[model samples]
Target chain A: MTIYLPIAELSVNIFVILGMGAAVGFLSGMFGVGGGFLITPLLIFYNVPPVVAVATGANQVVASSVSGAISHFRRGTLDIKLGLMLLAGGLAGATVGIWIFSFLRRLGQLDLVISLLYVIFLGFVGGLMLIESINAIRKTRKGVVPVKAPGQHPWIHRLPFKMRFKKSKIYLSVIPVIGIGFGIGVLTSVMGVGGGFIMVPAMIYLLRVPTNVVVGTSLFQIIFTTAYTTVVQAATNYSVDIVLAFILMVAGVVGAQYGVRVGQKLRGEQLRALLALLVLAVGIRLALQLVITPADVYSLAIGGVHG
Target chain B: MKRALLATLTLLGLVAASPAPAFAQALSPPAQGSVVERLEIGMNTSQIAITPDFAGADLAIFGAVVNADELLNSIGQYDIVVTLEGPKDFATVRRKERVFGIWINRHSVTFKEAPMSYTLSSTRKIEGEPGVPPLDAPGIGIQHIDLTPTDFLRGGRLLEDFRDAYRRLKMESGLYQPDPGGVRFISSTLFQANLKLPANIPSGTHTVRAALFKSGKFIMEKTLPLRVVKTGLEQAITDAAHQQPLLYGMASVFLALLTGWGASVLFRRD
Candidate 1:
């Protein structure tokens, strides 16, 4: 039941890893989000080396994103133009992220920085999602019909160099789209997440792209960004474990299929609320670890002696 | 002169009894002592091939002491201590401090040469036993392992704390084990011990040392070589990653894309 991971240099139960992959995959499929944020932290909790967890998590994202993107493409919901624009920025951002990752690793601050980033981002995103979902649910319970807003936000309209995305039926400035992609790309490399949760909301609210196209467009861009991250981590850090990635991907794909079916039976507000709670729980746990006094204050790492 | 002759005779007896032909070549010249001692060691296996499914391994180190006179044997004063040490490597130990209400690594000490894994086993309690000499003085326990910091002068009491912390962590991780009473004597001259190599054991040549103590004093010591290596798929993957990292990286990306595409096509419903 236990298998040895060559890159991670540890033994883990096969079923445990498979279950983790399936659970995260199911959530991602249901929510239209890449589950890297969940999977990476779970792996770290299971004592997988942090470097291996982050790198391999990105590799798994490549698979899920590719599958999700293709599905959207076939359904004619993908915004190819928007996806490509975001990808350009994502690629550039990922390169910078990798450099920062290496610098922090050399200083032995990579784990601390990673945990801190997770706590901050997850808390903010989760809190926002929870509040928004609760309000939407209350409105529906009060028998108030939901209304859709027309036109872009005032801030978005003020941006220069607007371009039309025919697929999403929108005209937006390239600067903000590229900036959003760049931010997602950095997250992909550094945090091993596809940044779908952030990207989906940004597209719906900030860019004012149609809700129907947001998930597809986000998945499309994530495929390339995460693929690039996987390669860079493998080459530069030698941290990616192909075996671990492959196993997780296989289970994740199967889980995603079941998740899609389950998602159809659930209401959007309920699903969002659940996901928000999950994210908040993980974030709070990580934050608590930082604030709590550790039983042992010392940690060891393999490297040359440094004064 | 008589003691040296007896030691030579005992060495010849050991060479004749040893199963491994290479053991003869590894022996050093006999040390000067009032009573000469002879050691012969045998391992369950000399080479441990770490296959893909290798969870861990248990090794039995059984050996014998020869050339003891009747007077020494009657007193029953001999003790056996065995240590298995993995390849030497540098390790950095960092201490965390609360800064602005968040714990963060503030200072670190580096050990110049530390074993990746070390297991110590003794026939009797190594330290703090009634009427027994402290093992630290004789370098017989895990605490007594010669660990020197890179910047020895800079680290004063802090260096000692780091060293203790490092040992504690290693012990918790099962990489450093100090097992008193792990060794047992089948008879006065024959002794055996068991030590486990954790699944995360580093792959390299490991040194197995056995020392014989007489009347709370060091008498003689012997060393055996053991090899731990990755085999088959584990070796292939590790070698590829280290040697052809770029190619390996490309392959990983390509594989992910192919699998993703294949899964989508295979599961497509329409």
Candidate 2:
């Protein structure tokens, strides 16, 4: 069946959209990621306008992150103070990101910029995760316990305005926390992601936050940032497709439930390796589109999207 | 008395061939040696209310030639061209070039007040006949539709390229459609023009123009206004997005929250 997306102003196969949502939701659930990184690119590949895809991607992230946040809240793994600090930064970054998005749109360069950013971030993150996971697998086979060396603070610790996060048992600068939050917030709006993939690693490696609290705190911040981005994108760009988002959210939540059960059976390093490969594949596909010669160089835009 | 009679004949001849902006027009096969031509055009429906299942619509417009020369009409020397022009707005056409190993939109040209969609239909070909020249009016056919550039109109032939690209893209996308033989004569003086309205046709006040040409020379023209409005679910969503954007945004967020919250509750871990 074909369903019309009111904001995208296009009719797409309902099954295709549902399958995409379900697939992405399953992966996010298995890996404990928000899945916005996957959904936006998938929607773009399906011929949804980038504007609508990005805006609606953020909206979809809200639903995908909600259950995870609630689970963490019940377990007391979430750090409310840290999440709030990140929220302050994220909200500001989203505002800036929206302005930048509109500016690139008018310049007719939004598509190129979006593709480039995705390729760069996805490639870097995927590469790092793959190498890290492979080494972890090797260590497991050798029967060596993987341990993190503590009491080592990098130059980031010297920054002023430091505050103690009792839940994470760390004293970190608010500036870096806000800065990371701001970056994630910007990505939420521009790329239509919850920034969880980036945030999870950043907290563990950079801030040295405990692994137990990282996923929960990241989810907490992502929920608000993506939700804020969705509302703002709807108000300003008017690009959010409620029909498309709803369908995706429904399929995603259901898929995640099944994914979480399967995830429990898989080993951690193997799961990370699999996710790394998937992310790399998506990045490479986007990179190829950037360098490939277009069938037609000239494009017509009448009243934005031609009749 | 003989000179006075000669003067009256000359005045009558001038009136027959003179431009008749006031004359109503239709789209049928035009005939040569016109004595006098007056065109009147009307549509089957005044407005098209697009329902949710609207794929597209083929509109039939009826027009007639009043006071047409009988001999010329019989000879098929007349051609009728009917065009449907959608709401106008400034449009931008962009061209991509490979820049530093990446394809990027490098150049852009803006057209001044171009119609969002253009549908043309005519009896015979609008650009018909080997010896006979095409219609002189610029607004008569798809190719002749005005697409004057807003800027970057240097003496180079580049402007022509941009204009051609714009039209070709529009045609390829079904925005600018043309049917060479869509107009047919139901009777000796009455003709009907069939215009194919694409599903993505802009909703607003559109203008349907019917121009009459006798022996490839413009005789008269007529215009009618058409309204295309979206109805049902599509209309409500579109209106809410544009008119009440803030509320629409809030509602969208609320929906997301509800969906997320509802899912978590339904599959709660007991």
Candidate 3:
């Protein structure tokens, strides 16, 4: 059956949207990633307006993050204090990001900027993940346990505004933590992603947060950042389609439960390798689109006349 | 302007004075010697309510041609063309250029006012026939439609290219459809046609025009007004989003938070 989306002003098959939501949700649950990076592109492929897709994708991320965060909270793995600090930075970054988005939109360069950002960020993150996972897998096969370094680098130690995070049992300068949060916030606002992929690694490598708490903390901050983005996009751009978001979130929530169960049976390196492949695959597809000539060189867009 | 106003008033007075039966008879072709032909048209529905489940709509236009000359009727040369045009809106077309190995929008042209969607159906092929009136003769096909560029870009050398691009893109999106032989005649005087509206048809007031031609020459034309509007939940949501965007945005955020919190609560494990 087909249903018309009000804000997007398009008719889409119910089953197709549901399936898309479930599939992305499952990956998000298993990998502890926001999946907006996946959903936004898929929506674009399905011909949803780019603005609507990004806004609605951010709305969906809020639901999945909440669902994932609750479980981690119950397990006592969340760093609430750290998450709040990161959220403060993220909010400020999102504001600046939205301003930039508006300026780019006025200049009719939003689509190009968004596509280029996706290609660059996805390529970098996906490439790094693929290499690390492959190396970890090779080490396991050779019967060698990987060792982690504990001490902070000189630059990180020298930063001002140091604070202690009790849950992760770490003392770190707030400057870098806020900077990371700000970067993720900008990405979340522009790309409609939860930025967990970047956040998890930053927390692990830079801040030396406990691996077990990283996912929870990232999710905790993501829920707020995405929520803010959703509201801002809706108010300023009027692009958020609540019905589309609702359908995706409902299916995503259920799929996430199943994903968590399945994740328990998989080895860490194997899961990471699989996720790395998925990320790289998406990144390559985006890169190829940039290089290949489009079927129609000319495109039409509705003028920016606010209703 | 005064003369036009007087003419319109006189026409309205004639309509008001005529009875229902007289009005019907008045539309018939003029007696024997007159070269004029009379056309009467009706639509299945004048207003289309777009609900949440609305995929698309098929519009049926039925009409009759009265007093077509014997020469035209015998030769099977009478043609009927029906067109439906949506409200005009500003549109922008952009061409992408390869810059630094990445495609970026380089050139753009903006149309001041263009139909958001247009559908045309004709009894016979609109083009490629000798002596047949061109589709854009006056009030016929899309070619005849007046598309003006924005004031700043008017009279530019590249105007034709931009117009062609706009038409091409609209066609690709199924917003502009021109189907030949779409209208069929049941008998000499009576004809009907169906216009298929795409799922993405914009909501607005549309004008439907039916024109009659004899021996490849335009004779008479009639226009009907139509309304395509969103109804029910779809209407409500769109209105809120556009009219009260701030409140709508806040509600959307609140709803998301509530849904997330509710899901967590429901699925929480002790």
Provide a comma-separated list of chain B TM-scores, one per candidate.
0.83, 0.83, 0.82
Question: B1-270, model 1: which lDDT tens digit per residue?
Answer: 564476456656655655468842314333344336677888999998887787888889999887764344455666788989989989888898998899988888888778989988887777757766644336667888778888757567888899899999889888899888888888767889888888888888999998887655677788899998887787788888888888887887787777777777877853
Top model by DockQ, which number?
Answer: 1
On a 0 to 1 TM-score scale, where does candidate 1 land against the true structure?
0.86
What's the true lDDT of residue B162 in model 2? 81
Tens-digit per-residue lDDT, A1-307, candidate 1: 8888888877778889899878876765565677777889889878787778888888887776676667667767689999999889888887787677767778776668787987998899889878877887888899987786534477877799999999899887899999988887777666656777777766765787755566668777877777777777888888888888888887776676555546545566666677678778768977987999988899888755554
- iRMSD per prediction, in order: 2.1, 3.7, 2.9
lDDT of 3 by residue, A98-198 (tens): 77777766877676768787878777877776787688788889998968643447799898899999988988889988898888777766655677777
* lDDT for model 2: 0.76
lDDT of 3 at B154: 46
Native-referenced DockQ of model 3? 0.40
Deviation (Å) of B119 in candidate 3: 1.2
After superposition, the stretches of candidate 3 with alpha carbons farther than 4 Å from their true spots are A100-121, A150-152, A189-194, A262-275, A305-307, B1-33, B130-133, B151-158, B265-270
DockQ of each: 0.49, 0.33, 0.40
The regions of model 1 sitting more than 4 angstroms off are A98-122, A150-152, A187-194, A210-212, A263-271, A304-307, B1-35, B136-139
TM-score winner between candidates 1 and 2:
1
Where model 2 places Cα greater than 4 Å from the true spot, the runs are A3-5, A27-49, A71-82, A95-121, A149-175, A186-194, A208-216, A259-265, A304-307, B1-35, B129-133, B152-155
lDDT of 2 by residue, A10-33 (tens): 567778988987887676555557
